[model samples]
Target: MNNNSSIDQSYTHLEIKIPLDPSANERLRSAVLSRLHELYGDPLPDAISDRVNAELDIFYNYFYSSLFLTYQKLVNCINGSGLPYYLFSSNGASLICYALGMTLVNPLPAHYRCASCRHTEFSNSADSSDCGLILPEKHCPLCGALMVSDGNDLPIEFFLGLRYDKTPYLALAVPHAMSDDAVSLLERSFSVTRKDPRDYKFPMEEGFIFAYLDIVPTDSDPESEMLWRSSSSAPSASSASLAPYEMTNARVFEYLSRPESFACYLPYRDDVQMIKSLLAADAVSVNNISDLSKICGLINSVNWFGFILPSLKSGAVDYRSTITCREDIFRTLVAHGLDSETSYRVMEMTRKGRAASILADNALRQQLLSHDISEDYLTSLVNIRYLPTRAHALELAMTVYRNASENVQG
Candidate 1:
């Protein structure tokens, strides 16, 4: 109805329409703003508020009318079960989604937040890396309390795109035991009339549910539901205790560094063996959660492992400073004085396997060089056929962490 070209015109022509509550947007806004204030203190930072409001506006104006009811239904079903789960991919990296309890990942830039004084300070300068975990130890200036360092430095654009027009999709991973029940609930809720019973179809696998709602036609007004996918896997006993939006756990990272722990998440035997070999040979070390996250990204990518493994094994490049995920490229460019937009463009291109073309552009090349971007870095980007997001990696790492912790306790 807004006449935005970015919205799929086909959606407008559909005969079905789900009646949305008039107060839904207002209620959502209130909840999100309350969560923001709770996380960042009263009178939220102008920058944070502006960014959140802008995203909210996009959702309200373009997406909420179509997806809100379905999302609400999905959330209700998932939360009703009391089972631990995580939203995967860029959707998981949204601050609004995190605040809405729709995701576990927090998309704020690397920062330190004090629990006592509610003081928050971003640490993403040229000198400091984008990873807060590696930042120098510091105490809150106001209360002298040690501040908690967290955040994955993911931009909202990663999920919503530059124009905020991308059709948002949700991919969730829930416990295997309740997957069938969740799917049945969704089917009943959406009045699902059709389904594709396929297993391990590319991204879909056993315990995966992909459903689209086609409401029964009626005499008055027809209704339809938004399409979404859910994946279920066997979770470790310890995973059930994970608190929502909890990111920092030193014990988890310690467990993740062990070679055998890689088996927890890596599905293939060979991939797990490769990672174990790397760890055994000291080819790569998992010093923190971020490091384990990089390993996740590398293993899932098309060419990154084969491309970078040699250098790592030969001690030519330290695994700690190497690029594994798209965030690494974005952080590197920003650290070299490139604006965030430009940095994101480069990162996006690289993820889409266009890094070679990026280096071929003379103007962009000279600009990058002027900012002291190394040719080696650009070359490294060329090898990135596909890159996983830090959000997904962290989610997987956290899952492994929870499982390992439970095993240790037992």
Candidate 2:
């Protein structure tokens, strides 16, 4: 267990444990294999799966992703509250509290406890238990007016600062660069990167970054935009001082380079059914019964078969079954770009009526709707499920639709 003394004096311990779900490895592998086969028409050699799995295993074990995923899923589930997408950051949290106080609205459940104070309150009032939140209330008995929540209108900088705080985790930079970028003055520099922090794989711009940033600039902190972090452990540095738009553009550039990053956002719960349907369709496309028979054999076992060469249809295996085979799918959709026909098909197939799909379908539908998405882009998205999530696919569809719509209107 690792404990941090700085944040909580009460002593909070984070535990490390290996995932025992034997099925997770296979499920994850098959997920990847499905993408590879769809993209490249066959499973990658076992060596590649081994490499990717090693990276994935490490990421899967991190608390940040789990926490972020939980927060995202929860916020997406809320109804009719146009609270700008919830974000992580000391100040952003404050902004949310402020908005909650102003609107007398609660985005989270009544039972939700403050991560800092462990206080639970249904509405804004000082009499309520301290939720450890930065801004408890506008006129509360507890921590007073650095009272971040004024209800509703939070300064843009607050949200900007919040995303900046998450940069190290999602941005994955060289230690030397992180130091130069994250720390400005010499006084607190040693405190932030006391250990060999560069050796750790800190996440920066994963799928959530794109899904959220593409919609609400709340998640985006342009380095050029002067911003401040309220934390006392470090000297204040303005985001604008760091660079033009700061490191935001740089990180975004990095994320867009990897097609797989975009691909990862496609896994809405109902997407599994859509993919299964597509696979069945593709299976029929092969035409040669004997060839189809061989491909199915490989596809069915591709999740664990180790290596595959569509040219050879044979390979070695180092792990249990979970080989992915979705390369062709990505290649096809990405190549065609997002289109109206594909988007419509995707929305139709992944909708609520699908009984065979996962229960998480509603979440996926909500995510898609959040992005102002249309049908054609949805089709392109059904192909990129490696980093699949409810928000990412919908965002992509919306972006494509918005662009096309604007072009036509112009």
Candidate 3:
């Protein structure tokens, strides 16, 4: 028994050294600064540097090193596999991740960036409210090349918290064909075990729990393919041949507004049917990315769809006015003169189904009412059992955008 115990201890204590590169921080800093210079031109703005530095500091200080190492390993394995994948959550909505090439979504405000001269411009008055794809075309002032419109106006707070307090979980969607292989590769690389086949847990120090990767196995083909092929009213064959990046935002929204086309974006068959019903009645409109995102959030939530559908049908509330996502609560309150911390608190409470508790405080309730927040809006918050984040909604919207673009370009 003593010999068996000795053997068990030896096995458990096997030295596994994944050395942390001493220069990693400096390298990351240099790479980020270089990319910013490339994107916004040399003599980088002070605001950009300060923001990036702060984010890096948070990462270096707050985030566990194993998380970064695991992410790098997974990315390297995925790239080697040659299967297409996309970051499917707030991680995708990060500027730092984009700069690091860990994600493709650029989280900058809606703007045009000139590839030739690196000239950038934000022409829209309501920059955060608009999608860059829908913006009017413009040529670079410094160069004749047409400027590229990108960015979802996603704040870094969506990825990190308001105080850079949130610990991130990496989520990625890989083609179903290679998901098993992806999981296996990740497990082998980490030398760690997964209780659930889809979630890979990384070894962390004591008290540093919740470090895991969520691998979502998804169909590789564009969701809109079947709809395009089946619909007689679909765009012309020539128009359908446009590349993903070539398709304009207006065209994408037009396609997404169709019940059949929009239904294709939904994951579950029941959700597809429910959304079809809503779209068929014209109770919902997909005018822009934000609208589409809200719809995504509505369907995924527990009571959000039921709560807003009647109002939408009766024309009492439009999609824009309703609190479809947690971000709406924050944005609305902040816009109506609430302080950032208070707005965030309200958002947090509302999302966690604690709005009743929030209202129970007379001072807080009075403060909300004093800001011209309607009783109806507060009531809607109380009904919310579950709410999606704006980051999540935007990620879904971007997925649909990319899939629509690919479907058309095919």
Candidate 4:
């Protein structure tokens, strides 16, 4: 059976209606066809058309679960015990926008500024149609810089197709530094991965950052019928602040210890050795993950994990299921490699857990006490360990001090 068979089964009962207008469907089909031809050849084959249609159907089918997994990864990277939030964008640099979007998390807005005139605009409009904000026709409002649609033009269409149900969230993915012109920002945003690799320059903000708030509907009707309602319909005073994540990409390092602790990477937990091998292999095509199992089976005498599962052999892992599982597995696996961290504090904390549990004998405590981490430090660390991220640690420490002070005063 597929690795995510258990997860898929639970959500199978919840059916969501996807309202597809014929005009919108046709436009999507045309765009897909054009895109396919651009990538392959002028003459598109019937097989290619069939495959594209199959992919689209799968994309629309598992929207909710995909969104959930995306949100979960962002939350884990940003809120883990040893990690910090800024690390997501600051270290992931501009790449966080793509990673977050690829994982189905809300993407931060990417902006481009005019070089000569310093005219700046959103890369994607909030309207969610094209998913990019372009300069007005050939004119930079600030410097009359002639607009040029170059390679750096944001990958808007790639993001638009991947969006979940429209939710109002603010993503500010500005790099800390940029050339006085828009071209540099574009270059920095979309350069070859090996050339720039996701490095965050000390004085730059050339990437996506996230801040999310609830877009609660005022009307009590079901979510499907609640269209055309303005976000401004609610009173501004009552709006809740969306929490912030520190912007950095170094957060990927925190995940390295995850494999040691959890026995498998959280992003690709099942059949992990194969997942890692696939990730390491550049020749492996992400377009079809089942082929990996097939190849594995062939090499292993044609009796791999799939052969062991009767359900999967009976068509349980259909195209829709594979897409859902593959997107999720790949998203998580990449995320494991993308987040950054200052140190492996969560692992240390887990050691502390084991010490406090059945191993709480005085001999064990004394053994742990021999380390640089003192008993008092360990106590404070344990208390503050529950705090969300490194950024919030200071506030939590202060709160602990204040609470102790108030008790003494009372």
Which one is best on TM-score?
Answer: 3
lDDT of 1 by residue, 227-341 (tens): 0012122232335446423435566556667776655544334456667767877887666566766776666565766798888889998776777667778878988999988
Candidate 1, residue 81: Cα displacement in angstroms equals 3.2
| Global lDDT scores for all candidate models | 0.60, 0.26, 0.63, 0.26
Local accuracy of candidate 3 as per-residue lDDT tens digits, 233-284:
2334333233223445677788788887777654344456667877887888
Tell me which of candidates 2 and 4 scores higher on TM-score: 4
lDDT of 2 by residue, 152-250 (tens): 112222222212333211111111212233222211211122223223433254332211110111111222111111111122223212211112232
> Judged by lDDT relative to the true structure, which candidate is superior, 1 or 3?
3
Question: How are the candidates ranked when ordered by TM-score, highest leading?
Answer: 3, 1, 4, 2
How many residue pairs in model 1 have overlapping backbones?
Answer: 0
**TM-scores for all predictions:** 0.72, 0.18, 0.78, 0.20
TM-score computed on alpha carbons, candidate 3: 0.78
Model 4's alpha-carbon lDDT is 0.26
Q: State which candidate, 1 or 3, has the greater TM-score.
A: 3
Model 4 TM-score? 0.20
The residue pairs that clash in candidate 3, if any, are: 240-408, 242-409
User: What ranges in model 1 sit over 4 Å off?
Assistant: 1-21, 65-76, 79-86, 114-129, 133-147, 173-182, 191-251, 267-274, 334-343, 357-375
As for TM-score, the candidate ahead, 2 or 3, is: 3
**In model 4, where is the ten-residue run with the lowest total lDDT?**
84-93
Among these predictions, the greatest lDDT belongs to 3
Residue 256, candidate 2: alpha-carbon lDDT: 23
